[model samples]
Target: MTPQLLIFDVNETLLDLSPMKEGITKLLGNPNAYEDWFSILIQMAMVETLTDKYSDFGEIGAAALTMTSQKHSKSISEEDLKLTLHLIKELKPHPEVKEALEKLKSKGFRLVALTNGGRETLEQQMNYSGLESLFDGFYSVESVRKFKPHPDAYHHVLKKEKTSPEESMLVAAHAWDIAGAQQLGMQTAFIKRPGKFPYPKGKKPPLICKDFTELYMKLTVDA
Candidate 1:
């Protein structure tokens, strides 16, 4: 079924995360450190939610950076941590993002962004990418004090949009995010970004496209 609303995940889905590679590699002294840092950040966010503790996504990210640095026996100064987190606000859209969004919008699909980033960070990132005007609405998990993969986060968006789970589809790069949406009864599309894959044990997403362009085609042409 064609969805009435397409809710997108902000980080790594619409925005390219390559901007963070330099800061992570410089701080951790490993070219592959970016992946490790991101994984830890998500893990900690889940930890905070599961433990019934609330922390801003940015705070969890900073703590994750510190933990990753210490795990590697590297010392990351506070300034360095701040700089690395700041890079998130400077991310650019993936090459095909603008065109794909335009096509989807022109076709009358309501577009919204749902992110784990706090409201301020989400605004900054969207403004930086110059894609803020394209969305009908933006949502942050901060209000719910939970991260993606948590049922409430997904439910909050459905409630706000007045769209039922079956009428909305979630498009995300993270396997966990897709799984969460799937469990909540929303159709899901996984953007197979570099080094990203679906969770092996979860319900499979109905659509797994290579990128935004592919996703647009799949939804418009194939669906």
Candidate 2:
């Protein structure tokens, strides 16, 4: 099938969150706390998705941070929490992101975003990257108040594009996002950026790439 829609996942996938990770680690009084905190944050997001609850990503993030600090017996003030949240709002996109996005757009695929980020947060990220207009439309899980792997986030993008799952390709660096989209029968483009790996236990993606440029080259044929 030739996919007409291309959906992307923000954060670690497209938008680099390393700066936020560094800041968080420093705030937590441990150099690797950010890594542990991110793992816990993702786990909690899925818990919200599976158990049927609604909370913004930021709130969940704060909870995860608090848990991490507690486990490590570290103390952080409210000011530190505020600063961490602010840093998330200012993450930058990877170097190859802009050009790859442009190429995908020029190839005639309708680009869209399916983010766990709230709407305002997505706007901030896109605007900061100076590539906000590259997409045909944008969306956030804020509407459902549930994060990815729940299928709602992917379905949201499909509905907005008015394209069937088979006709839309989901591109993401995270295997969880790819797995979530694939569960809905959507074609998947796994961008194996650096240390990322395949979904632990779910329908695996159909295609894989080292970066967006690799995915872009293979996009000519679509699915």
Candidate 3:
């Protein structure tokens, strides 16, 4: 079935985080600290949800970077931390993203972005990446003070759009985000970005594309 609404996960799913990875690695003085910091950031987001506590995604990211520095026995100044994280606002969409999204929108898909980032951060990202006009709606987990993989985060978009889970499809690079939407009965598409994979034990995505170009082909020319 063709979905009426296409909900996108902003970070690695649409916008490339490689720029941030480069900045973070340089800041931490370790080539691999970026991955460590990101893993901790995601883990801590879930930790906030499970504990019924909320923090802005930006704050969590800063804290996660701190934790990574501590683990590596490196001292990071606050100024450098903020500067490194600021790269997120300057990220570019993956090379083929803009063109593919344009094609999808031409097909009458109701495109939207759902991110774990805070509203301000989401705005900065979209605006800087030149994708703000592409989406019909922009959503952040901050609206409900919950993170993705939490049912409420996915439900927020559904309720706002008056669309059923089955009538929507979530496109993401993260296995956990796909799993969250899957549990709610939404159609799922996994954009297999480099260094990203679906969970072995989770529900499989109905569509898996190498990039948004392939995704556009599958959802349109090949549908």
TM-score of each: 0.97, 0.94, 0.98
Stretches of candidate 2 above 4 Å error?
221-223
lDDT (CA) per prediction:
0.92, 0.84, 0.93
Identify the runs in model 1 with alpha carbons over 4 angstroms from their true place. Answer: none
Model 3 residue 223 CA deviation in Å: 5.1
For 1-223, candidate 1 gives per-residue lDDT tens digits of 8998999999999999887988898888988778888989999899988998889999888888888888778987889889888999999999999999999999899999999999999999999999998999999998898888899999999999999999999999999999899988999999999989999888889899999999999899944
Query: By summed lDDT, which 10 consecutive residues of candidate 2 come out lowest?
Result: 214-223
RMSD in angstroms, all models? 1.1, 1.7, 0.9
RMSD of 2: 1.7
Which 10-residue window of candidate 3 scores lowest in summed lDDT?
A: 214-223
Please rank every candidate by TM-score, starting with the best. Answer: 3, 1, 2
User: Candidate 1 at 55: error in angstroms?
Assistant: 0.2
Q: Tell me, by TM-score, which candidate is best.
A: 3
Global fold similarity of model 1 (TM-score): 0.97
Please give the lDDT score for candidate 3: 0.93
Checking candidate 1 for backbone clashes, the offending pairs are none
Tens digit per residue, CA lDDT, model 3, 70-187: 9888898888888988999899999999999898998999999999999999999999999989999999999999999999999999999999999999999999999999999999
User: In model 2, how large is the Cα lDDT of residue 130?
Assistant: 81
lDDT of 2 by residue, 30-68 (tens): 877887888898999899888988788888889999998
